[model samples]
Structures are given as C-alpha cells and as structure tokens.
Target: MRELRILVATAEAERLRGVLVMAAAQVALGGQATVFLQLDAVGLLRPPIEAPRDGAHQAAGLPSLAMVIDEALGSGVAILACQSGLALCGMSAEDLPAGVEVGGPIGFLQQTDDDARLLFA
Candidate 1:
C-alpha cells in the first residue's frame, strides 16, 4: 500500500483545526500524516489549555480542536512548526508543545516530495 503523507498549512485557526480533523481521518484509514503549522497556525502548538487562539467548534457532538489534536498525536501523526513561524509570532521553541519539530520550508519540501501528497487549508 502507498503511504499517505499530508502537509497542511493554514493561517486561520478554525481552518487549521478542520484540516487537522481531516488529517486524522486520513490516518484512521491507514495513511501516514504530517501537519506543518504555518504562520498563525503555529500558535496552536501550545498546550490546548494554553493555546493562543480558540476558534474550534464543539457543536454536533464533534470533538473539540484540542481533542482532535490529541487524537492526531496519539495516532503518531508528525507535527512540525516552522521555525520562522515562531519568530514571526514572537515566540520561542519552548513555547511549543513537546515533540513538535522546528523545521522550515526547505525541510518541509523534501519530506513532501518523497511520494507524499500536499494539502493546504
């Protein structure tokens, strides 16, 4: 079976959560998934209670954004936050959640090009 790798880049907080849900779905179906937090999306790397932005919806019994992120992490989803993204937000490496790599565009490019798919939200 072909591996499914996803590169999700979104600046909007709400949209970023939605993309994460989608990514989790892909993984549920036996696909490998990775998320690249770009621009404002990098703010989400903080712990859920300390998250910078909160636009996630909990209506219709859907899991909250934090829940989905937890699911992704538990499922072994790779999370990358752009190094420049942290700088742009006036944040440091310590501000991010544990295990989130601080890699930029060049690294993202190489990972996605190796038989992986790219999706932007």
Candidate 2:
C-alpha cells in the first residue's frame, strides 16, 4: 500500500476533519499515513482540543474531531506538528497530546517516500 502524507495548514474545522478522516481510512487499509499539522492547524491539537463544528458533527451522529484524532492515533496514524507552527500559536510541544510529534516542514517532507501521496488541507 502507498503512504499517505497530508499537510494540514489551516485551522478550519471542516478541512481538518477531512484530513483526519482520510488519514484514518488510509491506516485501516493497511497503508502508512502521516498528518503534518502546520501553521494555524497546530493550535487544534492543544489541550482541550477545540475543534469547531464538533457539536454539529455530534448532532449528525458522526464522531467528533477529537474522537477521530484519537482513533487515528490508536490505529497508528502518525501526526506531526510543525515546530514553528507551535511557536506561532504560542504553544509548546508539551501543549500537545503524547502521540503528536514536533518537527519542521523540511523534516516532514524528507520523510516522505517516493510513492507517497501528498496532500494539503
């Protein structure tokens, strides 16, 4: 299976949810998946994990963004937060959950395999 590399640069609720769902799907299929949260997106991972539209999702009988993130992590989906993004959001590595990694864009890109499908959200 091919690797799925997703670059999440926005804090938009809908888009971030999509990225997480996609990453989880990829992992369920026995593929490797990594989600790189950059820019404003890094703030979403901060404790309390405020994902906008979470209530709407719950109303629609869908899993909330936080639940999706947990499922993804439990399923072995790798999630990275950009070091600069954390600083930009006034956050530190300790602000994020245990499974999320802290790194830069260059390092994230360097880890991508030739056959990986890269996406930006």
Candidate 3:
C-alpha cells in the first residue's frame, strides 16, 4: 500500500474498540499511523487501569487502550489528544504520554488528507 497514514476519530465506546483494532493492525503491518482522539475518546489515555470498558463496571480482559497505544507507539504510530476534548474532560497535556501531543481541530485535518486513509469511529 502507499505507506498507510491513518487517522481515527472516536468518542464512543464501541467505536473506540473497533478503532483500536484497526490501529493495532496498521501498526503490525508497518503502516505510518496517527490516531487523533477527540471528544470522549480523549479519556482513553488516562492511567489505563482506570480506563472504562464499554461504559460498565466490569473489567475488560482484552488489552487496555494504553497497551494498544504503547504498541502503536513502539511501532512508530503517533497518538494525539484533542485539546478541546481534554479541556472538556478536565485533562491536560501533563496527563498524557510523552508521545501524545495536544491538537485541536487541526487534529482532524491531520487524520484526513489526500494521501491519508481516514476512518471515523
């Protein structure tokens, strides 16, 4: 493929689940990837242990979002946290990973472009 550059946007639980899977696949396949988490999706980077799963009290056995992020980063994928969403969630840049940056609406632009393969989750 054209050295895949992917951007996934999601704030929904189910959508995030699917997007995570795709991100993992892309990284595993050696694609150049970036995930722009906006809205509630910004909560994903929170200290993973407290990460919610499908919005329930039950513990999800699947690898946490943080693990997926670490894996993606290990494979050279970039993860960005939306500035607006972080403010809405009461989060800050200090709370995110060193690899994650604060991006605004421009985050969306990074996710979708002429050569980028974009997916909105």
Candidate 4:
C-alpha cells in the first residue's frame, strides 16, 4: 500500500478535521500515513482543543475534531509538528499532545517513500 503524506498548513477547523480523518482512514486500511502540521495549524493541537464546529459535528453524530485527532493518533497515524511552527505559535514541544512529534519539513519529506501520496490542506 502506498503511504499518505498530508501537509496540514491551515488553522481552519473543518480542513484540519478532514485531514485527520483522511490520515486515520489511510492507516485503518493498512497503509502508512503521516500528517505534518505547519504554520498556524500547530496551534490546533494544543490541549483543550477548541473548534467552533465541534458541537455541530457532535450534533450530527460525527466525532468531534478533538475526538478525530485522538482517533488518528491511536490508529498509528504519525503526526509531526514543524519546529518553526511551534516557535511561531510560541509553543514548546511539551505543549503538544503525547503522541505528536516535533520536526521540520525536510525531515518529514525525507521520510516519505517515492510512492507516497502527498496532499496539502
């Protein structure tokens, strides 16, 4: 199975939720998946995650964004927060959730196989 490499560069809740869902789905299908969080997207991972549409999702019987993130992490989806993104957000590595990794784009790309599917959101 081809790997999925997703670049989550936005702070938008809906987009982030979609990216997480895709990554989680990829892993559930037995493919490797990585989500690289950069720019303002890094701020979304901080504890007590607040998404404006979280309530709507729950009301519609879908998992909230926070729940989706936790599900992605639990399902072997690799999540990397760019080091510079952390600095940009004034967040330290310790500020991220336990399963998230801290690294840069170059490192994230280097780990991707030639056959990996790359996505930007």
Model 1, position 111: C-alpha lDDT score: 70
User: Tens-digit lDDT track for model 1 on 40-108?
Assistant: 678666554332344334545666666767777787778788887888877888877666678887888
Please give the range of 10 consecutive residues that has the lowest summed lDDT in model 4.
45-54
Q: Please, what are the lDDT tens digits per residue for candidate 3 over residues 27-92?
A: 677666667788677876666424456334234456655565666677676777888889888888
Model 2 poorest ten-residue lDDT run: 45-54
Q: In model 1, how large is the Cα lDDT of residue 58? A: 52
Evaluated at residue 43, the lDDT of candidate 2 is 88
TM-score of 3: 0.73
lDDT of each: 0.70, 0.89, 0.66, 0.90
- Positional deviation of residue 74's Cα in model 3 after best superposition, in angstroms: 1.4
Candidate 2 residue pairs that clash? none
Please list the residue runs of candidate 4 whose C-alpha ends up more than 4 Å from where it truly belongs after superposition.
none
Pairs of residues at least 3 apart in sequence or in different chains that clash in candidate 3: none
Model 4 accuracy (lDDT, Cα): 0.90
Where in model 3 is the C-alpha error above 4 Å? 3-10, 52-62, 107-112
Better of 1 and 2 by TM-score: 2
Which digits, one per residue and each the tens of the lDDT, describe model 2 over residues 1-113?
Answer: 88999999888868878988889999899899999999888988878876778898899999988888888899999999999899999999988887989999999989997
